[model samples]
Target: MSGSREEQLAAWTAKTKRVGFRQRNWSVVRWLAALTVTLLLAGLAVSLLDYPPALAAACWVAAAVTGAIMLIWFFDPRRFRARPSGIS
Candidate 1:
């Protein structure tokens, strides 16, 4: 609060970058475990419902594509900021 606006901005920027870096630095094992669990759960639901093979495969593919899209959207730093109202 006591510093110049530029100093405050710089501090905020550094803190944001540090958080983003930490998010991106997650271990491979952790990533794999999360992915495995998600896929396993999806597969389980598909199996328990007794869906046909083709339908089950389609469902799996759709889930994967959707998940990828969601992950990309979630991790994009720009998504954290509000868009200007007139930009649309």
Candidate 2:
């Protein structure tokens, strides 16, 4: 019985191993990039429209930070980690 349980668990893990993880990560990166671009454009518009310099600077800074995070997530070496046994 113990052997059978282990086998079943192994099969289940194999079936679901890293399922949707890559898709979800890519989706997150896409959204982050979009947000960064939007912020950057907003900053540019604000500056062009003669808005407060501080506000425009804040927007640009936020865009830079989000862009950095997106790049980091995209280039990270360790992408996936297996779930602990019996936790799924």
Candidate 3:
């Protein structure tokens, strides 16, 4: 069911407060997940050598992509924007 405008705004405000408090924390979770997947794929690639080279190549490529994402998430400039103290 659709909620009223006031109710919706209140809910949004509460969620924003929670999200702001938890900011940058979930970045750790993403980095961990990326590293885990990359390591697993790298191991598989080593084990699969001389077999399906294409599959290993694909896994290595996926690892590289995720590695780039992890780096970007850790070093992104947009993540550090300063909030204005006064409302315009």
Candidate 4:
């Protein structure tokens, strides 16, 4: 509780990142699953509300693309590593 702000932040970041592989994988799975369900619900709601076909399809495509990007980004190994030098 007495460290400089940068020291405190580094300690916190290290602590948060100290999970085992299994735990990290589970966390990723849960995150993606929740996003999938939310997107599904939104898509369904849009369709039920009788939005124009193009609009509804666009919404679904956007949601799907966003989710795909997130999934890929989440599993990017570089993100699990420590920050590079000069990066605060």
Highest-TM-score candidate: 2
What digit string (tens of lDDT, one per residue) describes model 1 on residues 1-88?
A: 8799999999987876656532342344356447655765776677789876666676567667656756775576654544334532
Ranking of models by TM-score: 2, 4, 3, 1
The window of 10 residues in a row where model 1 has the poorest summed lDDT is 20-29
Measured by lDDT, the strongest candidate is: 2
Better of 1 and 2 by lDDT: 2
CA lDDT of each candidate? 0.62, 0.82, 0.66, 0.68
User: For model 1, what is the error of residue 83's alpha carbon versus the real structure, in angstroms, after optimal superposition?
Assistant: 13
Better of 1 and 3 by TM-score: 3
> In candidate 4, which residue ranges exceed 4 Å CA deviation?
1-36, 81-88
lDDT (10s digit) by residue, model 4, range 30-58 = 67667766776777788999977777677
Itemize residue pairs with steric clashes in candidate 1: none
Question: Any residue pairs clashing in model 3, and if so which?
Answer: none
* lDDT of each residue in 1-88, candidate 2, tens digit only: 4569889888767777646223235677889999999999999999999999999999999999999998998787564444456564
Off by over 4 Å in 1: 1-43, 82-88
Q: What's the best-to-worst order under lDDT? A: 2, 4, 3, 1
Q: What is the TM-score of each candidate against the true structure?
A: 0.40, 0.61, 0.43, 0.47
